[model samples]
Target: MGTAPATAFDTEALRRGIEGRDAAALLSLYTDDAEIRVVDRNTQPSHPKIVHGRDQVGEMLNDIYSRDMTHHLDRCVVQGDHVAFTESCEYKDGVRVLASSMVSLRGGKIARQILIQAWDE
Candidate 1:
């Protein structure tokens, strides 16, 4: 029997990227052609906000990490080429946001991701 190969995804790096608010570090985990679909109050399940390509994803990450907020990786699960995680954030004003994400990995990099999020209004 052959053993499975080790994945390149680094959960520790993910935690550091999110907690440290390092957009570039997070971006490094994604493939060049990665795609991300986000669903929230404004963008509902029927119509998700889609971001394609590393450049676009990078722009989004930069915008998010630039905000005056604190982020924490609540939970993370990895199974083969798939990963799921929950993240919580709090703004300076006390507003809170929570997000859950499922990601598909290709060659150890994120190829696609679906994220569902909610925030205090």
Candidate 2:
């Protein structure tokens, strides 16, 4: 089998994606049925959940991005088709996290992405 694409996903692209609110670039990393779950640190009892196709992911993220005051990508590690990273962001509604995620890629796009976070817990 041929080797995978040398998709060197760095902090810049991620930063741009978050700061500039580029959901298209962000969602392009995922597959058609990709899922993203963000456990909100600000909420109690339950976290703000997001799901569905790539379009929903974009819409959810775009909503947050539009109202976000600050977004910072703290750390990232990319290994072949997998990526693990921490992102810190705060919205006007007082939502935030130093969130970490593990993303598995298939055919050069995200097959599955899972996120977990621990802050003020």
**Using TM-score as the measure, which candidate wins?**
1
Model 2, runs deviating above 4 Å:
1-11, 41-50, 91-96, 117-121
Clashing pairs in 1: none
lDDT of each: 0.96, 0.70
Tens digits of per-residue lDDT, candidate 1, 2-91, equal: 977866689999999999999999999999999999999999989999999999999999999999999999999999899999999999
Model 2, 17-60: lDDT tens per residue?
86677777677666788887656554422664657778887787
lDDT measured at residue 90 in model 2 versus the true structure, 0 to 100: 73
Query: What TM-score does each of the candidates earn?
Result: 0.95, 0.70
Assess the local accuracy of residue 88 in candidate 1 as a C-alpha lDDT between 0 and 100.
Answer: 99
For residue 95, model 2's alpha carbon misses the true position, in angstroms, by: 6.8
Which stretch of 10 consecutive residues in model 2 shows the poorest summed lDDT?
A: 39-48
lDDT of 2 at 45: 27
lDDT of 1: 0.96
